[model samples]
Structures are given as structure tokens and as C-alpha cells.
Target: MLDQIPLEHILLLSAALFTIGILAVITKRHAVVVLMGIELIFNAANLNLVAFSRHDPVLMQGQMFSLFVILVAAAEAAVALAIVLRVYQHFKTANLNQIVTKEG
Candidate 1:
């Protein structure tokens, strides 16, 4: 099915997703939004990996790497959210700028 679509198209899509993720991470002040941006970046990388691996009949290195990426992203999100929750509980805000500004 993916063979019908050109690799260039897949690459373009991933590039766009990566750009959006970068922009979100740079512009968003909320900790959760930043985490979402990080996830988007991970997804973009996974998409590229899967696209490149689709043609492989053996080894499937890209697919395996993508799976690891997903696992790591999940672990990262969980830990990041836990930290965010703790920060929010202490500071009463999830906005990174506010938290930082108030810190001594």
C-alpha cells in the first residue's frame, strides 16, 4: 500500500511534522504543550523510520528502531508529566515562564 506513495511524499510529511513540533516547543510556554511538541517530534522520526523500513524484507532495522523510539517517547512522557505535576503542585501553574520567573 505504501509502495504506491512516493518516498518523497513521506519524507515531506515527516519534515512538516518535525517543523511544527520544533515551533511548538519553542513558542509554547505551558509545560504540557512542550511535552506534546516533544511527542510530535518523536512521531515524525518514527514516521520516517517506518517509511524507510517498508521496503525491507529482512532485518527490519528501521522498524525496530522506530519501536524503540516509541517506547522511549512513552517513558519520557510519563516522567515529564510527573515532573510537571510536581512543579504545578508546588507553583500552582504549569506555565514554564511563570514558574521560572518566580523561582529564586
Candidate 2:
């Protein structure tokens, strides 16, 4: 039943997802939420790359690069979360504004 939709519609959805990610990054102050926003941004970018690759199947570089990006993003998220946890253990708070205070 979903095959009737055009390719342009999929592209538009990707654009909307990207916009939502930007909005999340701008509106959220919590570290975890911001990280989630970054993930959304990465996913949106990957979706766009895949969409472009769909038209030119022979040139697989974009898709390969996007896969690497996804892997790097995963690693970044893991390391970032670990750092955030350490900071929380030391400071007793996860709020970015509080962590940036002079007290350290």
C-alpha cells in the first residue's frame, strides 16, 4: 500500500526530520537530549546520503561513507555519555549550566 508515494515525498520527510533535529538541538538544554538531537541530525544526514545513492547505484561511495559516519557517531555517543556520567558522579548534577560553574 505504501508504494504509491513518490520519491520527492521521502526527500521531504528527510528534510522535515533534519529540521526537527535542529529544533531539538536549539531547544534542549539537557546533555542527553542534546546528544539525542545530534543522533537525529546524523540519521537525517544518512537518510539524505542513502536517498542520493538510490538514484546512482553504481557509485557506492556515498553509502559507504554514510555507514562509516554512523559508526563514528555511535562511538562518539558512547564516549560522550561516559564523560557525562563521570562528570555527574563528580558534580552530582547533569545539567550543563550547573556543571559550567566556577566551583567545577
Tens digit of per-residue lDDT, candidate 2, span 1-104: 22356668878888888888898889877888888888988998887787777767788877998999999999999999999899899888877778865774
Taking all chains together, the TM-score of candidate 1 against the true structure is 0.93
Which sections of candidate 2 miss by over 4 Å?
1-5
Candidate 2 clash pair list: none
| TM-score against native, each model | 0.93, 0.86
Which digits, one per residue and each the tens of the lDDT, describe model 1 over residues 34-61? 9999999999999999999987848799
The total number of steric clashes, by the backbone 3 Å criterion, in model 1 comes to 0
Superposition-based RMSD of candidate 1 using all C-alpha atoms, in angstroms: 1.6
